[model samples]
Target: MSYVQQVMEQAIKRSPNEPEFHQALKEVLESLEPVIAKHPEYEKAGILERLVEPERVIMFRVPWVDDKGNVQVNRGFRVQFNSAIGPYKGGLRLHPSVNLGIIKFLGFEQIFKNSLTGLPIGGGKGGSDFDPKGKSDNEIMKFCQSFMTELCKHIGADTDVPAGDIGVGGREIGYMFGQYKRVRNLFEGVLTGKGLTYGGSLVRTEATGYGLVYLMDEAIKDIGKSFKGATVVISGSGNVSIYAAEKAMQLGANVVALSDSNGYIYDKNGIDLKTVKQLKEIERRRIKDYLEFHPKAEYKEGFEGIWTIPCDIALPCATQNELNEESAKALVANKCFAVGEGANMPSTPEAVKVFHANKIIFAPGKAANAGGVATSALEMSQNSMRYSWTFEEVDAKLKDIMVNIYRNASSAAKEYGCEGNLVVGANIAGFLKVANTMLAHGVI
Candidate 1:
């Protein structure tokens, strides 16, 4: 077996039952075959071995009280995976699915994702098994405070900086930032996704979604195609999906679909961004509620069936592994030309295979969905400078960054003999930077 294959097998042996981590490692390791063959020194130095393990894994108990005055407890984590280039940066995802395995998977993927942006930030991820879905504001606030009390020890303005992901959003960031300030007795850019009144950067909320679309726009445009008058299917109804829809519409693409955990909504007349934002962001209602406003639209029962909808492009903005091989084949059969991921690892390995095999213009989440963290790093820069840029300025910078990322990934793929294989290209491009940095600093 090859070194890549051996390392993957060893990783599985070391971390059994960590399917997500295994999946991430497999994808990255598989891509590194060409890279490793070129640089045998990386393997000789045990870079891959050290890179697989986090530098620090913090796990703690978070105790809080509900509005009913009942004592509650939740687990918290901060997987500072690697800081070869700069401080550890990722997001805190508050969901029931939060676990060490899932967080490590996210953190591992982040190591490369952050590198892909050509930013000075490293990789890390954290979250809790606490579900904020049905919690009241006060209860969530208490939970955030308790979670940060322990978290404050491991993070800072120049150290580990976290932003929002999934269940953790503007509200959650506010609660956590307030608690971090209270406990640390210091105010700093320790967190991104903050509200405008604080250290938050403009366009941070819409960065990932906008960036995802930006990457896709570059992809299709490379093939002499454009979003103008193209039919696009975007999954998810959260910040990523909502803003992606808005940007696609702005670019003249017809976004005809969006979804949530319960189901998906399809409107042949195109998705109403205003309605989606109001229903999901403001009201926190299910996507089915979208049908109440657009009575002419159709509501399906499951998210999987969404792939059957024909479109020129498909953006999987929902949770990880939400799209599978079956759905990918369905997309290919429907003659879908592109697939962009707005969420991390939203596509399974099998699904990715189908996209590549069919020659679909596939944009990996790390390269395509990196705008959020890139903007967070920008927010950190602004906080240090004690100033903020206008919306247009930050947005223009973001667009430039996305364009560069697309070019770098595309170029890296071609250079590495996998022309147009962004999965390999993104992984190699990201890994090469961090690995070289690691090599220069010497192994830790």
Candidate 2:
């Protein structure tokens, strides 16, 4: 068997049952075939083997008390996947679905995502299986404290910096930061995604979504197309979706849909950003509540049905594997020309294949959803300098970073003779940086 295939087989053998991690591994390694051929030294150095195996995996039990004085135990994980280039960086996700396999997949993806950002940050991801939904503020705070109490040991401003993901957000970040400070007795930028009042940088909240749109705009503009008057359907009503919808609209696109895990809402007349923010950001209610405000909008019971909506552009800002092969075909059949991922591995490999076969402009998550981590790095810089950039300044820098990502990915794809296949382009470009860095550092 080939070196890449051998490495993949061993990875699966060692990490059995981690389907998500296996899938992420296959996607990136398969794309590196051309690069591997060009650099036989990578195999000699066992870079593929070392790259797949995380440098460190921290797993601990988090014990917290509920509002009723009942003790609850949850599992926490931190996969410090790679730090060849710089410090480990990623987010901490808190959700019922979070597990070792999921965190490994996210961390593996982050290795490339962070590299693509052209920032001096390595890759890592940590989170817990503790569901913050329906938990009171006190209960959530206790969990964050418990989770951070142990996490603080493996992380620092110059070591590993974690932001927020999924169920972990500003509120949770605040709780965890407070705990980290108390435990470490140091006030540093060990975490990103902080609120502005403390040390958060401006435009950090909107960075991911805005960055997704900016990259998509660059991709589409290359084909002489623009967001103006385009019908855009974005899944998820969270930060990425909301801000993507906002920016798409700012560029003159008519965003018609947004969804949550429970279901989706389609506003044929265009989504009202205000109402979505109120319903989701403020009220923290189900997406079905969106219909009460916009009574004319249609609410569906299933999330997959959102893909059937006709549109010129589709942004899957939801969870991993939310969009499948069937959804990709449906979008293609409906004349959807472009798809940008705003979530980690949101599109299944089959879905990505369908998009490529249908000639859809597809942007993989590592490159497309990288805005969040890239901005998190920016926040770290701000925290280190003890200064903050204005919203416009931060936003401008984010746009430039995203644009360069697209250009570099596009150039890499063309150079490798895979022109327009951004999945391969992004993987190759991201791998070269880390692989070269690994080689220069010798076998760790």
Candidate 3:
């Protein structure tokens, strides 16, 4: 068997029951065949084997008291996957679905994602299987404190700086940062996505979503296409989805749909992102609540149906594996020309294959959704200097970084004789940097 196949088999054998991590590894490793051939020294140094294994995995128990005086317990995890390039950097996701395997998958993806940003941050992810929905503010604060009490010991401003993910947002970050301060007794930039008053950077809120559109705008431009007057379908109603819709509409695309965990709302007249931001950001309501504002709009119960709305561009900004083979075929049948992932591994491997087969412009999450972490690095710089930039300044820098990411990925693809295949391009481009850094570090 080949080196890549050998690593795949061995990794799966050693780490069974981690299908998410396996899937992530498969996607990246398969794309590294050309790179591996070009550098047999990488195999000699066992870079592939070490790359898949995390440097450290921390598991702890979080015990907190709810508002009703009831004690609750949840398992917490932080997988510090790699730090060859720089310190560990990723997000802490809070949800009922969080587990070691899930965090591993996210951290594995983060290594490449952070590397693609050309920033001095490594890969790590931490979270718990705690559900925050419908929880009282006190309960959430207690839980955040408990989670950070342990997490703070393993991270630092210069060591591992975590941002927000899925259920963990400004509120959670605030609670955790406060707790980290109380526990460590030192206020520093240990986390990104902080409230603006507390060392947060501008443009951080809209980075990922806007960055996705920016990358897509660049990719489609190479093919004589743009978001101008194009029909766009974006999934998720959270920060990423809302901002992506906002930017796409600003760029003249008609955003027809946005969804949440419950269902999706479609408006052929173009989605009013103002109402969406109000509902999701302020009211914390479901997408169905959107119809209450616009009676003429349509709401569907199933999220999978969102892809069938027929659009020129589809941005999957939801959770992992949210888009499957069926959804991919549906989008292609509708003549969708581009699919940009605003979420980590939002599209399945099979779905990616379908897009490639149809000659669709597929921007992998590591490249397309990198704006969030890229901006997080920017936030880190601001924190280090005790200064912040204006919104326009940060946004301009973000756009430049995103454009460079697209150019680097495209150039990498062309160099590897796979021009127009951004999946391979992004993977190769991201891996080479980390791999060479690992080599320089001398098997540490």
Candidate 4:
């Protein structure tokens, strides 16, 4: 075993209960073994240890009054993992699954993901164990306000900037931003994913999904293939899945599947993106609602079944570990040539192994999903300049950034003797940038 791996194993042994931190460090160090061998300075500088452990993890209670005139409290967390490259930046997800483990894993991955974007942003993630679903608008607003009340103390445009993820969208961001403005008594760009009227950047909503498709385009191009007439099955109906489907369709790919937490829908005639947009974006309804517009579609009750359908590309834009070894085998069995992750660690290590063994073009989340944070960094840039670009301009920039990220990952993999292995490439590319920055800045 390499020295860095050994050190990480020891660290994991010391904190056995911290699964999120362990998962993050394991994935990162596994691909970085060769890097550590080449650069002993990383070990001497204790970069691995620092990278595994967040600089600060803040957890607090979010107490609020619901619309029903009852007091409720929720747990909140913010894992500020690193700031060597720039300030802490990541999204805030609102779901019952939010915890220290999830936040740490997200933050650790964010460090590398942000670095891969070639942006001047470090890594951080924050959220609360507050499920926004089934809540009245007033209830969600109250919860968001309470959550931001504690979060604003540690975030700013120049410090850590939070964006939207999963259950946290424009509504949640607006509530949180309002709370931050109320507390700080300033209208700064303290949070991203804001409404257009605020200091929000254009194309921020479509960045992650659009970026995923852009990366997929690069991957296919690397293999002398293209998305033209390709069939794609994408899991999750959230922002990432939605925009990914839209962009893939625009690129001449037929997207046949999309899902939510409950289940997925498969339409052989290709999913109607406009219908999906109305159901998900406007009505905030379930994926099953697509049947109302397209009755011929098949609605399956679980997301796991999405893998059974045959397709040329698979994009797991859902939650972490959504794709397991069985799903990976299914994709390979069904002749899937490309898989891009739009969610953080959406594929398990075993699934990744399966894809690697099959020689599939697999792009890791740290690189594929880096577009969200990259656009957040763009939002930060606009905020710094007090200027907002048009939607077309911001989208053009996002595409360029995603293309560059794929090139960087591809080049890093080739240099590290792992050509065509994006997991290794992404880890090395991101780690080198952060490690070099940390070394240059000295131990903090």
Candidate 5:
């Protein structure tokens, strides 16, 4: 076996039961064969080994009081994967599915995602298995306080800066930031995704979803096409999905479908973003409620059926492995031309193969959905300067960053002979920057 294969085997064995981490490592390492082939020193210097191993893995217990005065407990994790280029930067997910494997997978992906942004942020990820659903505001506040009490010790503005993900939204960030400020007694930008009254940026709320569209726009244009008059089916009705749908419609695509964990809503008349925001953002109701307003639309009971909807473009803004080989094949069968991932590792490897086999323009999440972290880094810079930029200014910068990200990944693919394989290109392009930085800084 080759050196990369040997390292990969050792990684899987060392991190047993971490299937997500294993999958992430395998996918990243698979593309890096060309990189290690050209630079054998990467193997000799043990950079791959070191890169796979995190600098720190923090696991703690969070105890909070619910509204009923019941003491609830949850597990929390913070994996600082790499800081070769700069401080650790990523989001903190608050969902029941959060585990060591999931955190590790996200952190591992973050190393490359942050690198692809052309920013000076390294990679880290932290979150808890705490479910924010159906929790009262007071209960959520208590949980955020308890979670940050332990998290603040390991993070700083100059260290690992965490933002929000999954269940961690603006409301959660506010609670956590307040707790951090209380305990740390510092008003630094230790966290991103804060509210506007605080140090948060204007366009931060819409960055990731908008950025995904921005990257997809560039990809479609390169192929002599555009989103104009196209039909789009997007999964997830959360922050990323809503904004992606909004932006796609603004660019002339009829966003026909969107879903949540429960089910999906499909309206041929195009989804009403105002109702979606009200249902999801304010009312905090399931997507099934969308039918109450759009009586002409169809509401499906299963999340799987969302993919079967005929559309020109598909955006998987939901969680990992939501789009599998079966779904990818279904998408191709329906003649979907593009798949833009707004969530990390949203498409499985088999799904990726299916897309490539069909010649679909697949934009990986790291490059397409990088707008969130890129904007988080921007928020970090603004917080450091004690200033903020207007919505237009930040939006423009985000667009440029996303366009450059596509070009860099595309060119890297061309350089390595992968041509249009953004997966290989994104992995290699990001790994090269981080690896070279590690080489320059010398192994820690």
Candidate 6:
């Protein structure tokens, strides 16, 4: 190992409790091995050490009132990992699983993902351990308002801009933006996933999912393959999976499966995208409810089984570490050719190793799902210019961005002597850009 690798390994060993942080840093450092050897300035600057640690981590209590006149409190976190490229920009997730580790992982991945977008944005992520599921609209609004009450103090248009993730979607963004506007007493582009009335960009909702498929399309085309007649299995029925399914259908692929936390539903005849959108987005119901709408579909009680179903492509749109080594093995054993992560770090390091060793065309979340934040940055541009691009225009731009991102990653891997390894490619591509900026800016 090189000096930089030794230093990074030692630093991670010293912080064993921070496995997510270590895993994210290790992946980047491993990919940048060749770059570190070439650019000794990065080693001298201790970029790896600085990059492993977040610039700032904020945690606070979010107290709210329920319709029953009861008080509830949840923990909120924001990990501002790096701002060498620009201001801190990412998303706010509102799920029961929110924690420091989860936020750190997401923020670390955001750093690279944002860098790949070629937009002037840094990396940050924040969220609360408040589950929006089963909550009434009024209850969710109260929770979001309360969560934003404290979050608004630390964020702004130029300082830190947050969008939506997981449980935090249009409704949550609406409530949070309303609270921020009320508290700050100013209407600014402080958040990206805002409603159209409040300056949200057209096609922002479909950006990430569409971007994932776009990246997948690019990767397959590079290998003389196409999405036509490809069988796909997607985890999570949220915005990402819903639109990914839509785009996959448009590309002539059959998306056979989709999942929620409760379980996943598989249909041999291909899933009905409209029914999923209505159940997950409109009704806010569970995945099990799909059985009521389509009796022919098989609903399993866990998400892991989704991978076991035979398919040509797999998209893990659920939470982090959703696909483990076992699931990855199942996919590869079933002749899965591609895996694109729509969710942050949905595959474990072991799962990634399996995919890489088996030569699967794997696209990391940072590279594949960057479309969301890329469009969010575009939204910021529109907010500043007081104009919004049409959906077709924004989508066309998104496709171009994804194509460039894939080329950047592919080229980075080749330059680093790790050709065909996207994990390394993405890390090197993202790290070099941010590291160079940090070197130019000096210690801060």
For each candidate, the alpha-carbon lDDT, in order, equals: 0.93, 0.95, 0.95, 0.90, 0.95, 0.90
What residue runs in model 6 are displaced by over 4 Å at the alpha carbon?
9-16
So what's the TM-score on candidate 6?
Answer: 0.97
TM for candidate 4 is 0.98
Better of 1 and 2 by lDDT: 2
lDDT of 3 by residue, 201-287 (tens): 999999999999999999999889999999999999999999999999999999999998888999999999889989889888889
Which lDDT tens digits does candidate 2 get at residues 1-444?
Answer: 899999999999999999999999999999998899999999999999999999999999999899998989999999999999899999999989999999999999999999999999999998999998899989999999999999999999999999999998899999999999999999999999999988998999999999999999999998888999999999999999999999999999999999999899999999999999998899899888988888999999989999999999999998999999999999999999999999999999999999999889999999998999999999999999999999899999999999999999999999999999999999999999999999999999
Better of 1 and 6 by TM-score: 1
Model 1 sits at a Cα RMSD from the real structure of: 0.8
Off by more than 4 A, model 5 = none
Candidate no. 5 TM-score: 0.99
TM-score of 2: 0.99
Writing each residue's lDDT as its tens digit, candidate 6 over 1-444 gives 677678777877766777777777777777777888899999899888788788999999988898899999999998898999988999998888777877888898899999999999999999999988778899999888888888888899899999999888888899889999999998899999889988999999999999999999999997788889999999999999999999999999999999988789999999998888888888878988988989999998978889999999999998888999999999999999999999988999999999999999999999999999999999999998888889999999999999999999999999989899888899889988999999998887
Candidate 6 lowest-lDDT run of ten: 11-20
List, residue by residue over 1-444, the lDDT tens digit for candidate 5. Answer: 988999999999999999999999999999999999999888878999999999999999999999888999999999999999999999999999999999999999999999999999999998999999999999999999999999999999999999999999999999999999999999999999999889999989899999999999999898888999999999999999999999999999999999999899999899999999999999999999999998999998889889999999999999999999999989999999999999999899999999999999999998999999999999999999999999999999999999999999999999999999999999999999999888887768
Instruction: Name the top lDDT candidate.
Output: 3
Q: Tell me the TM-score of each prediction against the true structure.
A: 0.99, 0.99, 0.99, 0.98, 0.99, 0.97
lDDT by residue for model 1 over 1-444, one digit each (tens)?
Answer: 998888889878988888999999999998999899999999998899889989999999999999888999999999999999999999999999889999999999999999988889999999999999989999999999999999999999888999999899999999999999998999899999999899899999999999999998998888888999989999899999989989999999999999999899999989888988888889899999987899999999899989889999999999999999999999999999999999999999999999999899999999999999999999999999989999999999999999989999999999989999999989999999999999999878
Residue 173 of model 3: what lDDT? Answer: 96
Q: Candidate 3 at 248: error in angstroms?
A: 0.5
Candidate 4 segments exceeding 4 Å error? none
Poorest 10 consecutive residues of model 5 by lDDT? Answer: 435-444
Better of 1 and 5 by lDDT: 5
